[model samples]
Target: MKPDIRGRQPANRRQKGAAAEEAAAQHLIQNGYRILDRNWRCRTGELDIVAEKDSVLVIVEVRSRSGSSNFGTPSESVDRRKMQQVRSTAEHYLHVKKQYGRPIRFDVIAVMLNAELTTASIEHIPNAF
Candidate 1:
């Protein structure tokens, strides 16, 4: 297994990311967002979360990283290519679900986990795209 710059194993990083995504999902649920799907995927790409608030469908891209990592903030990691892939994946989801004419928006949930990976700081950006 490859070790990160800080000597942490790759599996540890994956575990941290998964934990962060779970926390982000729970945070959204507590904020009145109904989760429709998690890890929805298509030929284009994968969406981290699909949720709804009121009548609007929200596609959420979850970005997660350790607090002391060199990867920069989670939000900064979602670059233009990532946004494009997310947009394409959302289109595929809409077509497959036959969810036409419904209001849609892209969102981003940035999660920063503590050193122990138990606590998280979450930033929700609605209409991110």
Candidate 2:
């Protein structure tokens, strides 16, 4: 018997994540954020969202999990390692965009969905790191 060594996320989960990102983007736009990019990637890593508001460059991390518990809140999912990766990745992005001397901040948007796939809760933490 062979083993499932791919370690890939299920299609449904990927879809849910994509939906969450889109929702997050909309929320940001409504809140006066100008989205610069979505799913920006490089050899270092992938950034879920990049935006600007009030002349400040913002790096947003979106996380979504379907459940009824707060145990897996999105903010809790971003650990120190992930923050470090984000920092390096953001540097790469800034260099690529030639955005030197711009104030930058990291933000997090957490989405919790109901069993029916409806939005249950959303929390946006700005200047998270």
Candidate 3:
């Protein structure tokens, strides 16, 4: 059973996802990353997170799974179709927002959690795609 987020907060799955995302964002900020955009979207798809670290345009995909990477973690979940969508999303972000113009790379932020929904570890694979 999931914990109740009432009497002080929300009480649903979506709210929990938001909470997890926020926590992950904080972790990134603490590691010297500047948050560029969160939940950036286009007609094609959405990038979970976007940040800049050391003058590099980092397109981040946040995947929260309820276990370890033993069988298959979140980062490994970015299949070929997903990669294509990410590429398109990155292109759109570059042209439309005009924020990231040079020196860009794709990254995956795999967030693993325990059965109780507590964060176990965050694996960051830079230049993954």
Superposed by TM-score, candidate 2 places the C-alpha of residue 117 at a distance from the truth, in angstroms, of 2.8
Q: By TM-score, how accurate is candidate 1?
A: 0.88
TM-score of each: 0.88, 0.87, 0.80
lDDT (10s digit) by residue, model 2, range 6-120 = 7544347777888789889989999999999999999899999999999999999998888755576777999999999999999999999999999999999998876456678
Q: Which of candidates 2 and 3 is the stronger one according to lDDT?
A: 2
Report how far residue 19 has shifted in candidate 3, in Å: 3.7
- Give the runs in model 3 whose Cα sits over 4 Å from its true position: 1-16, 68-71
Across residues 1-129, which tens digit of lDDT does each residue of candidate 3 receive?
Answer: 444455343235665466557767878899999998998888999987888899988888777676446778777788999999999988999999776548888888877766456778888888888
Worst 10 residues of 3 by lDDT: 2-11
Assess the local accuracy of residue 52 in candidate 1 as a C-alpha lDDT between 0 and 100.
96
Whole-model Cα lDDT per candidate? Answer: 0.89, 0.88, 0.79
TM-score rank order = 1, 2, 3
The collision pairs in model 3 are none
Evaluate residue 117 in candidate 3 and report its C-alpha lDDT on the 0 to 100 scale: 62
